[model samples]
Target: MMDALERVTGPANATPGAASSAIAPVLAGPPQPVRVLAAFPAAVYLEHATGLLAVVAADGVQHPNAVVLSVGVAARPLAGLHVGQEGTVGDGAIGVGQLQVTVARWFDPSPHLRATSPPLIAGKIADARAHLMARTGSDSHDLAVPADAVAEALRSGDMDGVLTAVRDLVGAGPGLTPAGDDVLAGLFAAVVTLSPAVAPEATTTLTRTLALTGGAVVDRARHVTTAVSAELLHHAVRGEVADLAAAVLHAFTGRRPLTPALDALLAVGATSGRDLAHGLITGAALVLATAEAGDPDRPATTVGAR
Candidate 1:
């Protein structure tokens, strides 16, 4: 649970408003955390004063339509707090608050939120972060793709070969690539040798490398690596400037830039192009689809008195 918050916070740090806006609506008002975890990628659980409302997203890649995950009749506020209040994020709990609760993927992969983890992912996340810091020459490592490896991987058809090589170098975090790893040394060299304007020249090489990596497993592996990277960025990106334009674009079109901070948090939040390609998948289940399982006119928005 703690790990998930830290992980997603990586990219969120770069784009504070975007991150804050994302969880704000869902945790609108206050109440006890009834459940946490995603059955789909772009899902949000809302615990308000009146009731427990599951926000059925309508974002294309994450939510094609609005659908509810679950609804609980709440006589009292969630997290034992007041209505219209937010929580302060902390180490153990999702955030320190007495209002609306925000549950993270780390706490509950299951819809039931029964299987709590031992925070082991925290260490793995730290290792990945340390690896990035050492190799990136700075806290951030975007634009530094291993061109030689990417070029070679492009020539080679073996996606596994590409990933194996990448794991060897950067040790995998955020948006790592097979070729990126094999030529990380060279990639860094290319960036350094070149002017600051072209420091991220490795990006072109990495894009080409992905074409060769091929298929589901490699793709999922990339996402997993991204999750790891996102966790590491928790320290690097937090409190930094966030890109609202980029975030909005991501929300509208399932694609995100190859940015380190963006990629890392996107993976952790499971909001990448790969994760929510349909704008209908939240963390685990398709709540929107489920909500409109039978009805055709899915209520787009609430008509409340302003």
Candidate 2:
């Protein structure tokens, strides 16, 4: 039987303060996390390549929203089964404290996935490219050089080289969370989907790269990009062909503005939306470039190749 742990709505030590002007707006949205607590037991399942999907029980009750955990690693033993779990908050355990949560649902294809098709994917790629071209004149594109270098390093199995290229790309874009980081995150996700076997090593390199490029700003961008990219990659891993394609496609084509998932990424910062859009386009370009190169062990083609 699962252990019954008491659920504290917020931090055990927290007292509800009278709403004040300064703190009101920050608290306007969904509830925020409080104190750090012990790791409570949870039920874990694989959300395909997305990462761990965990339903932790608080007071032995299930939560409607399962926490989607993203770790850049290959498949684990829990790939398709439900099992008891416990882990640190930094690893994607969501709660105020050591709140126990139970899995309410896992990987339900978003309704948005239905709109995807090959032509849509192709069209979005074209549209995103055109958008970049229009934005910067002549389609020279954003992050083209570094993205290509990272892809080449991946194909060549040079994890260190990949890390260097990623750091350089992410370090230089505009905004608090440079747009390049988001695109790099997307590119990372695509590579993970196209080659699941490489994730463990790739993740190792990525973790180290992020460490070397440390800063409060970059860290924030990393957090948002990692989450967004993991979701996209997980959809691809599950063969949710339409939804996976739709996520990026919509970001570029915009028949619909931003999907709920993407919107969350955007809300991370002031310029997150614009940066994410640029990232999506650039990420797609990287994927197209690699796919067209036709060699898993060679440098990726340039965005202009197609």
Worst 10 residues of 2 by lDDT: 16-25
**Clash count, predicted structure 1:** 40
Best by TM-score: 2
Per-residue lDDT of model 1, residues 84-163, tens digit only: 34433322123324322233322111011121111221222233334434533343323223322332453333456655
Candidate 1 is scored at a TM of 0.23
Q: Which of the numbered candidates is closest to the native, going by highest lDDT?
A: 2
Which residue pairs overlap in candidate 2's backbone? 55-101, 55-102, 55-103, 56-101, 56-102, 57-100, 57-101, 57-102, 58-100
How would you encode candidate 2's per-residue C-alpha lDDT over 40-129 as one tens digit per residue? 233332232213233322222121123422211132212332223333222112332233332222333322322332234446667655
lDDT of 1 at 94: 32
**What is the C-alpha local distance difference test score of each model?**
0.27, 0.38
Off by over 4 Å in 1: 1-96, 99-148, 155-160, 170-306
